[model samples]
Target: MEVMQKCCVLFKPDTESKEMSGDSLLEVQRAKRAANLRESLFQILSGLYGIMIVILGAVIPITEIFMSEEIDSTFEGFYIYLYSVSILFLVYVYAYLLRRNRLKTELLTRTLSRSLSSSRAWAKGLARPDTDTKSKFRKRMISLDVSNHHTGTFYLRLGVLGFGIGSMIHSGLNFGSFVSVSGGDCSEPVQWVKPLIHLMFTFFQLYFIFMNSKMCIHRYKKLARFGLVHMCSTNICVWFRSIVVETLHVIHHSDTRGHHGAESGHHPASDNSTHARSYPHSAVGHGISHHGSPGPEYVIHDEGMEKTLVDNMSHVHHISRKLLAASVNASGNISSASKDNCHWKNMMSQAVEEAGPYLYPCTIEYSLMCAGILYIMWTNVGKRPRRPTRSELETDSEDDGVEDEQRAQRMSVDCTSSSRGLFLGILLMVGTIISIIAFYMLVNQEEMQDSAIFLTHMSGTFIYTVTLLALLLAAARMKNLSFHNQQEANLEDILILISYTGLLVFIIFSLIASILAETSTMSTLTILSNVSMLLQATVQTIFMLAGDRMFAATEKQVRKKPGREFITFLLISNFAMWAINTFQTQTPQHNPIQVDFYGPEAWAIFTHISVPLGIYYRFHSTVCFSNIWKNAWKKRKHA
Candidate 1:
């Protein structure tokens, strides 16, 4: 019998005559009122925060373009719509918190600590002693992906709890919203945005410190598995904390699928075409819910159903969507055209090829980047007690040779980037410091309105865009579809031109936005530090895209390699900024007097672009997988 000491669970084969009964599991899985109380406090604060984010996200745009007459101060009127959205989101969040807490307390086990029924195992009646440990080929074909830890789940949950709350309030009249740069009535942070942001950010700050903070008890060499590191300050600690939280998020997602059938009043959608309004496909904001061992399964029989999941995933470009479809198809619940699609097969191969190692670096870099997020004045969690190894932290820009492939094919991996990122960042600083000079040199210096300035903006934006394209081109030259795919007989190449143009635009637009914002010349950059902001907006997106593909590739079958799609999203969103231009100030103003007053308005909607929809998504995520969540919780509780 398997005795899981750490898990605190015992193993037994039959549940029919067990020490713990199924009723006990239900009791273990029941939600608790005490936890509901905790959730209530969180909701009151986060609800307010959600209201604020709704303002920032929703109101600002409306005020900018439609209600331009009320703009006398900062974060003005941003609360009107923000409050509304916050109320709605806060309600949902609080309810969810209540449900989840209940689940935590009452979780139970179905059978034992070990011995899963094998899908492909032969009749056990005549079985002899088995010595071979070789994993079956079919197992590889059916298993869902559990790699990459639970970064997305943990991070998003924390983010939803933290930024979801803070951003909401920041958008509202909350204290987290703004300051009086000009000392005007509205310039001081609004009262509305205050409580929410404070409560959420307080939690954020606390967790940011606790997780990343290390007390140096001992230091081991690079490969030492166990030891301690000490953190005494908050400098660069936000980044450390945020990244650690994010990493744990990934672990949580991978550990168990999110709770399936999570809905207040909705039932799981039967087909792939329609989506749940609450959870959507996966969790909101790319919260993935995986089934089986691998991500998406390639059911080889049906065509229409297979395409349904694939197309949905294609539309979103998220890892979990595709994984879900694959899982469903593999389980024979959907069509099988997916397995027949040549391009889809090729994409799966290429994704595996590139992503296998790319994920390591992304995790490393993302954690290191967290330093900027912990912008509080208290502690420095990222501080190294001793030298961390390249393997331990692929975060350092200096580290190379992370993998031992050493083969010529592998040796030529050109992950080498411009290395000019720092220098270019410096240029942005110089321009910002001497922005007055920059303003003076302009034809409409006093007005801050120049058509030529727009041209320069467009041109500079173009150059940055062109450079992004160049890298993509080099990457394409480096590799191609490797699975020797069989192109679908019915497949016709879509508008290749549109696809390429759309992709290039995404990479460039965000790249430049970030570059222009980092004029702050402080040793400690704010969490929204100019460079860090730029990285978050542009570099982080790129990393997430890469991370998704790398993570998805571990499965037996894949739909499309997502590297190219990542490039496309960048281009499209960049092009989308034109919508903001509709309200660019015509008169001279130091900065555009853009403001909003409400939540759930247009801008608020825009901020929620990446937020997923569907009851399934709210409950079932790619990680913290919903399918196993019930059992895992039950097992833990009954243990």
Candidate 2:
């Protein structure tokens, strides 16, 4: 039997250098439980705060009316400004991500590391891995195990931010909406749907906060040390520092750097630079030059210079025995042979494998929690959208350096399929516009409003379908500008047309089932958002499946970049949609017009879809970055 033990001691200084024997995984589990409990407290606090804020917003109007003062100024001063700050802060996070990405690419091209290559193929026929001359960091990442991956940790504290905001502002907005419904006489409106939506969405935000909080605590605790009190875990600080503040992971992934500081991106000898033309193609290891140094400015490739860290296994078995005993309460100790073999090694091996990857919780888990909250809050797919920041597109993109012309050219997609889909979708869109127009016309007018309303119903439904298809067409057009395939432009337009047509038809029926409340009641402007989220998820799944199959057929030889535009649109649309619904439900003139955006029974479907979607998208981007980091190490060698 192999007693549980640590394999390494960097220095033989006895007690201080002992191998890690305690159950770190067990600690993580405990952290998760603690995070959940804290989240529950936050939820309670958030609920109370939301109610207070809502009350404040509601009462201020009545207070102003009594005090005989201009109430609008107070709202503009505090509510609008505060809300704008939070929204802008959210936008800043995204801008930071894009900036980090460009820097990451530059970094990877310069980084070099000792971990860079293998000859005669390491995995044999099982995996057609990248060539021996490729950056070593990329090699290590491909063989990475799950649990080591930094995605999906924030399941506990997902919706807290929104919950807190909603609780604080919901009542104020609701009362204001009531005032609007009552023609500003400081009287409540008779509408039941808006109040219902508010209550339901409050619960939804609570749920989101709970999930992310839990995941955060688990990940955060991973940074805590085994013995010393207040000996800060480098992991927590590094991850949070980067993600929330500096975007460290983003840089690491763009271009991998080595401990010794080596360039990780492709390098070819200056001599060979003239021999081959074009990037990716020239760097690709199909041909070798006779007189080239390792390449570009410097270096060379050699198999014997490389080494695998997992070549020995005396300590792996020991670690496995202890972890198993801790997790499962096993009676018998693990055997040495089996430890070195598959029997005991499998679980430990899996853990060991995953240890490097799941270093931090990523964005997918964060989004899933949000989606879950949405699912809990609403019966329908639509919410009043925040007035689309029509001006934001002009200013923000320039600062972020995203080209307006590029976006415009992409939007003006030339293919008939894309335009035709929009055209076909327009019939559906017109119906929606008519419905919205009819809704407003009814809001102000008093003549037989109820009777004429039903007359425009079918038109509204058709417009819902067309609007969805139009957005789908728009999203696909954005996707094509990233790639360089001639046939793909036509194929994508066709695929988008078909996909939208199918989705539009499917989602319209879903709304039919949700006919209890006129989705228009929630927010007339945001009806198109439903189409956006659903389509984004579906498209991602389709591509992921395709990528999987492609890799399977080629044995990991698939050489395509994942869809960047789709991911960008998918995330912004999803998050912005969720966050902006608050803007939709609130009217600036009133303290806030109250309505529930996330309800329990129906919208939980969105939550279920989105939480996982957000988490995966964010984490996957991180993982993709991990693959991109190719450390440059020539400086250390020269030193």
Residue 376 C-alpha lDDT in model 1: 15
Q: Compute the lDDT of residue 54 as modeled in candidate 1.
A: 30
Over 1-639, each residue of candidate 1 has an lDDT whose tens digit, in order, gives 244653344333454446467767666666565555654554355334434443444333323232223333333333323223324433432344223332222111111111122211211311331444223312221111111121222323332343233322222222212221223222333432433443343344334323322221111111111001111111122222222222222322332233322333234444544332232322121222211111222233355665675566334323222222221010111112222221223333343323322122222222222222222111111122333332222211112223334423322322112223324434443433343335336635545444334433443344335435533552453243222133221100111122223333332332333333324321112112223323323432332223222222221212232243323333332322221121111111212111011111221222121111111121112122211111111111000
TM-score: model 1 vs. ground truth:
0.26
TM-scores for every candidate against the unseen true structure: 0.26, 0.23
What TM-score, to 2 decimals, does candidate 2 have? Answer: 0.23
True lDDT of residue 515, candidate 2: 40
Q: For candidate 1, what's the RMSD?
A: 27.3
